[model samples]
Target: MIRKLAIIGVGLIGGSMARALREEGVVQEIVGCGRSKPNLERAVELGVIDHYTHDIGEAVRGADLIVLAVPLGAMEATFRAMQDHLADDAVITDVGSVKGSVVEDAVKVFGEAPAFLVPGHPIAGTERSGVEASFPELFRNRRVILTPLDNTDPQALQKVEQAWRHCGADLSYMAVAHHDEVLAATSHLPHMLAYSLVDSLARMKENDEIFRYAAGGFRDFTRIASSNPVMWRDICLANREALGGMLKRFADELHGMADALEKDDAEGLLEIFERAKAARDRYIDGVE
Candidate 1:
């Protein structure tokens, strides 16, 4: 059990983890750290953390487990700020979506990937932010991927794996590059498309009418567009290489569909629609 767990950036992801750990008695204490003192104080008052601090060094000083839940862009500065305060035995982990940039940042800050520093991503969250939006059940039945470096300490890796499991997440392991590519295609691309579609529609001449007539499909598809812009901006920038590649491929596919429609090619349109529907059904069936 973690005697003291310090969670940096006590927003939805961090607050959820703290709530889950506290509920499960997996940790003795949780210290919430963030730039906003009122947010951290509110987290404490909501019982998401035992204590709150604006100082990263103070929060992580004696923590055996430190969870970095800040945005991808903030990883480097946060690591540098808390490195000196981290215990030698402390196991460091993060909940960043993009792994390649995170791994690179770890190397830059520490000169190498420390055995105790584990890069992780929890594939779960609502289109919500802040401490109040968090819930203990956020990670329940969700997938949490860990990308461990070659030099990672076996004990540290196992401890983090166990901790996520305790939080009700199913664990998986992947290479950093592979994880980045997969997430770029699966998660990042969809979010980008959603934001673009919503933005385009909202700028139309009959914008209010368009929204008024919007049905369940538009609402469901653009739900993620309501997510924190800063977080998504950082994610897109962090995984730009993979994300750009995926975007190009998606654009090619869209162009093909448009061409088929313009040419009045029923077979081509049917082939594309049928293939996508079948693929989506198979994916849903597999997940279910």
Candidate 2:
């Protein structure tokens, strides 16, 4: 029943959401807002949005739902700009990977985390970005986590949940701190490792040969390294504390593996390998 849906950042995630909503006939009109005029124009041309504007206020006015799909770094400024322009009963949500910082910024800009302001993260995306890379089925069968504060309104939370459900997302709820910590390990740290591994290998003396000989495993493991740099940069910085803790644990495990290798402990290496394989198998089994 969204009369007008306004997306603040009309990139891949936002464009995908708009497309999903349009397919479901949940939104009557979609308005796109971004800093780049050309990008917005392209979004309109692709029919990802009904109209485009650089003015945040103009885009959000009369909109019942506003989705902030911008990078983590630009959230505070975007929230501040649109705070006063939002309709009285408008529901504000975001697709940001980090939740704690997003909640804090929302409180800072809106005086508190109102029930209508739900901090969310859709556990879905590909390495590609931009409006052209968007697809309506991107969220199908994917998990969407919503971290709603204590002061958040039940009705507002339900509305946001239903919207995601309409987009074919499975919904989960968690505390903001818990969400940040879990995402740090599952999403943020993995991306960091991918980027680091790729960068380190690319700087080797025989870099060309290394890449040329890389197999599917290497390509699959580092696929996320091709993600948007600025986006990951902001996420890593914003969740630095949690990500740092995860990195330390990861380093310790790596050291354990190194110790086993140095001692030629085949048993130890096999145990670690088997345990990892078991864990991954369990996850795949559950998901499938």
Candidate 3:
């Protein structure tokens, strides 16, 4: 059990983690730190945290577990702010989508990725933001991937794993670079497509009419476009190399589809649609 849990950003993901751990009676106290006092107050009102502070040092002073849930762009600054104040035995972890960039930030701040620090990403979240949207069940049965360095402290890694398990998450481990690459393809690319498609249509001359006549498929496919833009922007920039490769590959596939359409290649189009349907069906079946 964690004696004291310090959450560096008390937004949706951070607040949800606190709620889950509190529900499991695994954390004695949760102290939230964020730039927004109103949000922190709301977190306190929602019982998501025991207390709140704007100072990173005050938040981590005696906490044994620290969760860096801030955006990827803010990671290095957050790390630099709290490093001097962190307890010697503190187990550090983050929920950043880009593991390699997070590891790089830690190295930049601490001269090396500390043994007690574990980089993690939970493969779950709605197109929602803020502490008010948080719930204890957000991570229930969801996959939480941890990318701990080879020299990471075993006890620290175990503690972080235990915390996520208490949140009802299914934990998995991978190398930092591999995690980034996989997430770029599966998660980041989809978000990019959703945002790009929505923006493209919204800027059209007949955007109002287009949206008014849109079907369920369009709404479902673009739901992620409603997600926090700043967070997604940071993620894309942090994992640019992998995400760029994915975007290029997708563009090539899209060009091929366009060519098929222009040539009236019904067989080619049907083949692509069938393959996609089969793959999606397999995924849905596996998850269900």
Candidate 4:
């Protein structure tokens, strides 16, 4: 049981976890820390957490469980800020999307603390950010992937797993390196395409009313592009190697698509379409 839980960052993911942990009765006290006092107050008003403060040290000093819910970009700074205050037995984790950089940062900052676990929870998030956007069920029924490195303590890892499971998430494990590579292919690349496509459309938005006529497909594809810029920017830079590789592959495929159109290669087009359709079907089936 978590006697005291400190969540650093009062945004959607952090606030949501605070809400769930409080409701589930896993933690006796829930404290929130953030740069914005209004956001911290909002979380308190929403009853997402039991307490709040802007002092990272005060919030995490005696916490048995500390979660850094800030953007991936702010992770290292938060670690440095809270490191001196973290309890010796406390298990620290974050909800960052990218794992490799997170684990590396944790090792650099918390090297002396063998009980630390820099586990990540990549529950599919909404484009919505900030405290008001959080809901207790955001993590429910979501796939929370935890990337545990080799030096991570098993007990610490299992405690974090229990926390996520208590929040109604399905747990899965992967190496941080492997997780970044896979996400670069699945999540990262799709987000890049979404951003680029949406940016192109935005440039043309002033010229014509294309958005007014766009269908459900366009909305679905552009939804991720609407995500908070700073967060996505951090993710892109943090996992640039894999994302760059994926981008190259995407560009090559784009040229292939252009060629398929120019050559009127119906056989090639049909084959590509069939393969993509089959892949989507498989993914849908798995979810079902």
Candidate 5:
């Protein structure tokens, strides 16, 4: 069990994790650190964190596990702030969507990637933000991917894995580069498309009429557009290379689809749709 848990960004992911650990009785104390005092106070009032601090050094001073749940862009600064205050035996992990960027940040801050840092990403969340949206069940049955460096301490990695397991997460491991590429294709690309689609629609002359008559499918497809803009902005910039490659491939496919439509190639369109449907169906079946 963790003697003390420190979460740097006590918003949705961090707060939910604390609640889950508390529910499982795996953590003795959870102290949150964030810029917003009101939000931190709310986290305390909700019992998601036992205490809150605005200072990073104070938050992580004696913590057994430190979770950096801040945005990808903030990883470097957070690491720099807590490097000196962290206990030598404390296990550190992050929830950043872009593992490559996070690892880079660690390397820059510590002069090399620390052996105790285990880069992780939980493949679950709603399009919600802040501590108020957090819940203990957010990670139940979800996958948590850990991208440990070559020098990562085995004990540190195991502790992180066990903690996620206590929260009902299925654990998996990947190389840092592979993890970034996979997340870029599966998560980042989709969010980018969702936001682009919604923005495009909203900017049209008939935007009001279009939204007024929109159907459930439109809402479902653009639901991720409601996610926190700042977080996604950081993710996009952090994984720009991989995400850009995916975007280019998607753009080419869209052009092909458009070509098929313009040529009245019903067979080509049907084939594309059928393949996509089959792939999605298989994925759904496997996950469900």
Candidate 6:
């Protein structure tokens, strides 16, 4: 059992994890660290944390487990500040969406001092943020992926798995490179497309028409586009290579669609739409 846990960010995901673990008695104590005093205080008031601190090192002082829950861009800075204070036997993990850059940046901070650092990503999030947006069961039934490097400690990796399992999450192990490639297709590229489409539409003279006549499909498609811009921007930059590759593939498919439309290829268009419909239906029915 993890007796002490320190979370570097007390926003939606971090706060929710703190609340979930504490509610389930998975951890005896949780210290939330963030720049906002009010956010930290609100987290404590919500019973999500046992203590709060603006000082990163102070908050993680004696924690047996440390979760770097900030934005992907903030990983390096956060790790640098907390590296000096990590407990000798602490197992470090993160809730970053993109793992490749995080793992690469964090290795130096952890050093070769028999440290156990595991980079993890949870394929789950609400379209909300901040301390007020958290709930105890946010990760319940969600898939949590841990991307461990070659040098990761077996015992430490197991402990990280145990923590996620205790949070009611299903676990999967992946390599950092493969994780980025898979996520580029399943998550990042879609978000970028959504943001692009929304931005393009928002620039139209009849923007109101697009939003006013939006159906459920439009709403669902653009939901992630409404996510925090700063966070998403950092993710795009951090995982630019894989995202760029996916974008190229998307462009190729788009050219095919354009060609079909230009040539009045009704059969091709129908087949394309059918493929999309079949794929979406299967996903909706949880067939995948």
TM-scores, each model vs. reference: 0.98, 0.97, 0.98, 0.95, 0.98, 0.95
Q: What is the per-residue lDDT of model 1 for residues 1-288, given as tens digits with 9 covering 90 to 100?
A: 999999999999999999999999989989999999889989989999998888999999989999999999999999999989888789999999999898889889999888998999999999989999999999999999999989999999998998999899999999999999999988999999999999999899999999999899989899999999999999999999999988999899899878888999999888878998999998877886
**Where is model 1 poorest over a 10-residue stretch in terms of lDDT?**
279-288
Q: How many clashes (backbone N, Cα, C below 3 Å) per candidate?
A: 0, 2, 0, 0, 0, 0
- The Cα error of candidate 1 at residue 224, in Å, is 0.8
Model 3 lDDT per residue over 1-288, tens place: 899999999989999999999999988999999999999999999999999999998999999999999999999999999988988889999999999999999999999989999999998888888999999999999999999999899999999999999999999999999999999988899999999999999999999999999999988888889999999999999999999999999999899989999999999999889998999998887876
The CA lDDT at 201 in model 5 is 89
Which candidate ranks first by lDDT, i.e. highest? 3
Give the 10-residue window scoring lowest on summed lDDT in candidate 3: 279-288
- List, residue by residue over 84-141, the lDDT tens digit for candidate 6: 8877788889999899889767765655423488889988887799989988888999
RMSD of every prediction: 1.0, 1.2, 0.9, 1.7, 1.0, 1.7
After superposing candidate 1 on the true structure, give the runs of residues whose Cα lies further than 4 Å from its correct spot. 285-288
lDDT of 2 at 201: 95
Cα deviation at 177, candidate 4, in Å, is 0.5
Candidate 3: the clashing residue pairs are none
Candidate 5 Cα deviation (angstroms), residue 286: 4.9
User: Which of 1 and 6 is the better model by lDDT?
Assistant: 1
Candidate 5 lDDT over 140-244, as tens digits, reads 999999999999999999999999999999999999899989989888999999999999989999999999998999888889999999999999999999999
Compared with the true structure, all predictions reach lDDT values of 0.93, 0.92, 0.95, 0.85, 0.94, 0.87
Between the candidate structures 1 and 3, which one is better when assessed by lDDT?
3
Question: Model 4, range 3-32, lDDT digits (tens) per residue?
Answer: 899999989898888878778888888999
Q: Which stretches of candidate 6 lie over 4 Å from their true place?
A: 108-115
